[model samples]
Target chain A: MGIEPGRLQFSWISSAESTKFVEVVTQVTNAIRALGPNPDFTKKLAEVA
Target chain B: MLSYAEKIREIAGRLLASGAVNMVIGFRQGTIPMMNEPHFAKNPAEAAKLVWDSHCGINLANYLTDRKEKIGIVAKGCDSRNIVTHIIENKIKREQLVVIGVPCQGMVDKRKIALKCPGEITAVIETETQVTATGNGFSQSFDKKDVLQHNCSLCIHRNPVIHDELVAAPVEEQKGIDRYADVRAVEAMSPEQRWKYFEDLLSPCVRCYACRNACPLCYCPTCFVDESRPQWVGKGQDPSDVRTFHFLRAYHCAGRCTDCGSCERSCPVGINMRVFTKKLEKDCLDLFGWEAGLSLDVRPPLDVYRPSDPNDFIK
Candidate 1:
């Protein structure tokens, strides 16, 4: 559903600690959100989020 | 000293008074002194009975997360570490807690301590400042540190991790080699010999699930063992099956097991569950350089993964 670990890291660590936490959570939550609500880990996460 | 006791009462009473939590879990003198079971005080009146000392070692925070109502808890060193993991895992919300952190010298291990006492045997009894065993119609008092649980023997984190109030100034953390260094002798055995070693140890297991039930981290509403639809382990007495249950459950607590020793302590069958849990405890520290539940910030290593994570087995 998402591009790559390197891409995730860039989006995540490219900023300060608070920004980093938000960046990573947003990226990962967004990636899982992209998979839609199907009850599999990715989809279920998105549905909840 | 009355004030110290009263201070404990005050923190618990105020937390109850403020509507800060729905229940406050602490230790109360059980029918027996040696038996420190987790206790709950749903109101200020019940909070008065909460007590402390080396005897108050049982981790009450283990009970907090599973309940739907918000609760505060009296946490000692080991208890707070377990609480830390519950927070990291999202098992309990941090805001709902009112931690009454108390310094711990160590907690008495009723079973181990009983053997060392003067009696051929009798019940362990306690008072506010001293603990005595009444056996053979006589009583003798011992210093609290003289007979403590195996974990507390090597415990360094003798202060609460997260506390709203402190009971006493924190004691300097103790340092000692792994008390379960005996497990290494078992590790030196040949595979076949090691197999026999575990075979000897776990053979007594009745599959009573006492260890699982006692574990703070064994939080699934339906555990893997209970999944009858696709059984992770069959309900059988076969040696391998017994081994699988012990091995998996011990590993399940890898970074998560704070060596609270609740598993082996609560087991009615007298299995040496410490051997397995301590091995996992040492391995997690050695391999990952990680300790579970020490802080709120770090995610548990197993539950949160990294692409660069190490594994010698992976090609």
Candidate 2:
């Protein structure tokens, strides 16, 4: 629940709005990059003994 | 509060006697003090067993989901709101319901009252403004205001929002109450701190799903936690799974949770899950100017699209 707001983004884009789609994609990617690797929700793989 | 029980019984009896409703859902005295269980009265005789008190905290609307017969339910403010939600959600039709509304003062918190007495509570007596709990050798009286459920204390909707008949005159609603102070406090915390806070809050969770069971909104035939084909959450006591369960459960009620406190009241470990739902409620209020279950004429904000709706969170 404490996940950053930018982790998930929602936008409505028409098929014709190619530029808007690109801009939103770039914004989302940047936001994810800024948050860095998410160690919280990811399940850890069991180590071989 | 006791007087309301007589009127409730009379109304339930009349409803059953007149054949206006096939069943009247209300509360009966539980085996223990301050714990009332939901009762279904199919005839006038059963209706006489219906009682009203400060402990009728379990939401009656939970039992109304997809019910077929005509039902006359005893509804307090939150219960009526949830009934409205049930109708809007198409879980039940409004035409099949005859809501008997109660002007709720507030339901007392049993946990709070229990904290005052050193021994087991054998009996609890309630007056209009005071609660007296008696045990083997001790009796303590608490001011009603001091022991009200957290949600009830902050409730502005003391009167039923919708009803076919009123049990008593609507009590004056609480005015100018700061309902979101705790939510706002959580929102002020940094992400890491908030995560730590929730981790501590949910650590005691045993995955019993009592909260989900008690919630009227959680009528999903197969909740995400139970789906094994593509399991959304693990069944064990993993912290992430617990968080996911709580988060997803809260998200499912985004614009629909009435803060009835049934989820909190039903929790065996007494985890206050209202903070999770209350945050979304505050968001709904702030972003969409909406409250859940207030009207039948209008749809919930999340269920409809309007150009005027806020989209600032979008890229």
Candidate 3:
């Protein structure tokens, strides 16, 4: 398997870096994954697709 | 002009002198004539090879995830937007990075420019910092517009989005145009026509996912399509299976894609991938009045929802 390419491999990768947006994105992506697509709602998508 | 080369060298020298960064990610001449490839330089000698010019068009920001240690990178407008998306998504930390901002009006669509300016030319120059290209030969100079890529005309930023150091005074701002004019035409169609168009595009998909890998926003640790434990998509080539992967990606990235043209550029099977992304980009702009990744302060639309979020089908 090819190596997993990181977001900025061509640049410095740092763990100590603090993101001003981390709290917001965590709240966001978690909210998204938590709300699994509604089966009934997706059923409509199924029809549309 | 061709000043990016010397500027990169000068910046690399300063970084080396200060021990500010240990490596520099920039472009080096490629084996192919007039082609460039990403390069990593650890020392001043190697850094001296860094180059940024018309041919240095590849976006280097995609390489930044999980990489530890301080390093500097060269980034253009679209590439910088991608960096912002990664930072906001927590995929890459924003610190420990030194972005060498290079003012790029636009880069030549190599293949197209080559087709236009066949054989050696005396000089090829950017006519406008980010809007025009002009090439000169023995006795003739023609507007670079003749060979500029479609993306260039619609480019809103000809300058880098983030940078520790500025290379060449930043170019004047360029107005963003509705580059997805063609996508709007498809949307103007009735919902039935829109579905038909999408189905047609999805049906031809081989599900190779060259589109996903090429996308700047697609930086997930594990793509949903690749999940086998719960099995989102079995490794099948059925038309229906292919459509599932395609639409899911578009829907996931509905309000997030910047339409940098990389997904379509990276597709090998000749799928018109742009149509779907552009349609979604336009819808995000129209419905939510939002575009993705430009501002780190604004959460991606899908990731944040208002209690009053509009849903026409909600009961």
Candidate 4:
């Protein structure tokens, strides 16, 4: 319920659209990098691991 | 004005006597006022014990998992939907089942009745229009429609999508229902407020797994909670642990849950766990125009993906 909005991304691309897929992936990687790691799941991940 | 109990017994008896099925799964009257037990009838004599009423809220499809015997089962709208889910998920074979479908009105919410009459309910008499509860030196009556479980009141599917036999003609589905009112209200809150809302909502969880066990869709051989080498959730009553458990449980049932209200019904402390699952149900509907357990031909939402699917949330 407390999930921050920027921590996740969703995209739709067909298999033939390789350039579009790479562009979208690069954009998402940059956006997530700006937001940093998700604190909510990171703590739980550490506990479980 | 159909006599459901009598019809159930007749069908069950015939099935068992004719050796069409080895067992009939339905409800028997409980010792308590408003509770009923899921029962298995092996013969005509045992089939005679089967009874049906509004208190038959627990999903009978939960009992169909991994059973080898050819069975006849009494199924309400939600129960039959879960049966379809079981068939699709390989929990049970379609040929192995003889589904006796009943047109459900709704199940009475015992918690609502308790709030109405704050005494130990000694007896309950229910008709199509009213529910009368009598207890120690007190009697109370409420309109039947008012005391329905929250999910039932908003249910759109009142007739079985699949059935071998119908106990009665299908009832009219509820129209003009605002099913996502609660979900929308929660969405309107600030993230911190929403966080506190859920924290308070799940604070009473005892982690008994009744909610998990009650769900016909939840039949994993070994659940993620039970993972030992990489223990996903701590066994203690930590708030974080409780929240994590609820989150994962709801996520696991993304496109599989049929909103049968069994999880909420089985909670001893009366936790409204449907809040979690309902969000996913809404997402599935909006994104994929999908309702779980409606058909055996199509796969669940998460199982199939479309290249042209909407993805506005992406960067």
Per DockQ, what order, best first?
2, 4, 3, 1
Docking model 3 quality class: incorrect
Which is the better candidate, 1 or 2, if ranked by lDDT? 2
TM-score of each: 0.78, 0.94, 0.72, 0.90
Per-prediction share of native contacts kept = 0.00, 0.41, 0.00, 0.45
Worst 10 residues of 3 chain A by lDDT: A1-10
The residue-by-residue lDDT of candidate 4 on A1-49, one tens digit each, is 8766766787788899999999998999999998777664443434553
Q: What is the interface RMSD of each candidate, in Å?
A: 17.4, 1.1, 13.9, 2.3
- Candidate 1 residue lDDT tens string, A1-49: 1112232333425345887787678877887677544321121122453
Q: Where does candidate 2 stray beyond 4 Å?
A: A9-31, A46-48, B312-315
Which candidate number maximizes DockQ?
2
Q: Whose lDDT is higher: candidate 1's or candidate 4's?
A: 4
Per-residue lDDT over B116-183 for candidate 1, one digit per residue giving the tens place of the 0 to 100 score: 66665456656555677777867777766666677777787878877888988887887755555776
Look at candidate 4 and give me any clashing residue pairs: none
Query: What is model 4's DockQ versus the real complex?
Result: 0.36
What TM-score is obtained by chain A of candidate 1? 0.41
CA error at residue B115 for candidate 2, angstroms: 1.8
DockQ of 2: 0.58
Question: Per-model C-alpha lDDT, please?
Answer: 0.73, 0.94, 0.68, 0.90
lDDT by residue (tens digit), candidate 3, A1-49: 0111121122232466557356545665566566544332121322453
